[model samples]
Target: MPDADRQDATLEWVERVATFCVEEWGLTPITGRILGLLMICDPPERSAGQIADAIHASRASLTSNMRLLTTIGLIRKVRVPGDRTAYYRIEDDAWEKVIQRKIAGLGAFGDIAEEGLALIDDANPARTERIRAAQHALTWLRDLAARHPRDATT
Candidate 1:
């Protein structure tokens, strides 16, 4: 594809990613756009101004999302030699971190289910079955993730 067409297609994909993040993860569309751009942008790192321009986002709006993404280990800030402007790039293990966080959340929900089970009365064991099911499902997922961890070489 021609360069301009490629860029247009890339932007469309970025918007799709933004929509997905908004619907599924409760993140702002702009946050997802930043992530998508970082994932596929040529040179792999971009200054804030370039990101803002490409995503059609205001610098002010990008700043907080950038900080949040950086804090959560999805992205990182770098300073090129002889260049004072900061650049951002997606972390090499960003997806793994995302999955790890999801697994941690599952573990937390399992703990909560355990507490609920403890509170249920012995006279009504059926009342605790739902909680037990939820706990079991979470435990199964966590175990599955452990059994088939991502290979670093990939």
Candidate 2:
């Protein structure tokens, strides 16, 4: 494809990914746009001004989102010798860690469910059924996340 067409296609994908991040993941549109642009942008790293121009976001917004992303370990800031500006790039294992963190968070819900169930009187075990079921589901999911996968070659 021609350069202009390729650029248009890339932008299209970025918008789609940004939309999903906003709707499915509950991230702000600008943050999603930053992530989308960074995911496909050349050189694997871009300065704040360059990223702002690419995503059409203000420097103030970029700074806030970059700080949040950096704090969460989703991205990193790099500085070159003799240059004051920081370049940002996605973490190599960002998505994997995202999934792991989500799975780890489920453990807390399990604890909550167990506590709820414990509050139910033994004289009425049926009253605890709903909480018990949710606790079981969470337990299963936690176990599933921890278990090893089967070999595809087999």
Candidate 3:
């Protein structure tokens, strides 16, 4: 582990990441903290209690957040032999999986925009144009990511 001051600074940075996840991505603060902690915690795995103490979250909240993260395959719990406590670590490809899922979800928006375009009458092309623009954006994003899967990992 780093020295106390260094650790504190890192934790502060982690909290900023959690705040971004909460405000921009709609993730629970605790969940975001867990993700951020797993990414930087020394030794690469941490018990629930250790995580709770570091993030100033309760055990109960950590339990639920860990469960959700595990269910989504973002993190995993490992049991050490002769030890009862579960230690959690972020998946090696967690960000890749997350980005892939988001990309897949964006594809659905194209379908939605297509349906929206069908709803309006042909006489009002302006409305259809707006819907078309939305679909175009989604397609551009989807194609751009597909073209450069390597960049998406970063």
Candidate 4:
């Protein structure tokens, strides 16, 4: 394929991935764009200015999104010794961290359910059983996640 055609294809893939992130993962369009660009770009790393230009976002917006991504462990900041700019790239275990956080969220829900059970009337056997079932399932899932190793490649 021609070079221009290849570039077009890459941009198309980036758009598709960005849409997926927004629709399925609840990320903002800009966030999805950043992720998509990072995933496909050469060197697998980009400075904030480059990311902003590619995504058509302001530097401030990129700064905020970068902070969020780093906080969530989805991407990491890379500093070259001689350079003042920081580059960002997706972590090898980014998806694993996502899954782990989701599982941990389920465990938090279980905690809430337990608290609700304590406050609810114990005499209502049917209601109690339903809540218990939900809690049990959450607990089981959390335990199952704990037993498995985090997927290293994402």
For model 1, residues 1-154, the per-residue Cα lDDT tens digits are 9999999999999999899889988999889999999999999999999999999999999999999999999999999999999999999999888878888789789878889988887777777788899999987777777777674212
Residue 71's lDDT in candidate 3: 98
Quickly count the clashes in candidate 3. 0
Order candidates by lDDT, high to low: 1, 3, 4, 2
Clashing pairs in 2: none
lDDT for each residue of candidate 2 in 1-154, tens digit (9 for 90 to 100)? 9999998998888889889989988888888888888889889889999989888889998899989888988889888889987899988877776777766678679878989987887777777887888898887776777683222111
Scored by TM-score, the top model is: 1
Pairwise lDDT winner, candidates 1 and 2: 1
Clashing residue pairs for model 1: none
Whole-model lDDT, model 4: 0.84
* lDDT per residue as tens, model 4, 73-148: 8899999889998999998877777777778888888878778788889799999998898888888777777676
Provide C-alpha RMSD values for all models, in order. 2.1, 3.3, 2.1, 2.6
Per-prediction tally of clashes = 0, 0, 0, 0
Candidate 3 C-alpha lDDT tens digits along 22-85 = 9978999899898999999889999999999999999899899999999999999998899998
Local lDDT at 55 for model 2: 81
lDDT of each: 0.90, 0.82, 0.89, 0.84
lDDT of 3: 0.89
In candidate 4, what residue range of length 10 has the lowest lDDT sum?
145-154
Better of 2 and 3 by lDDT: 3
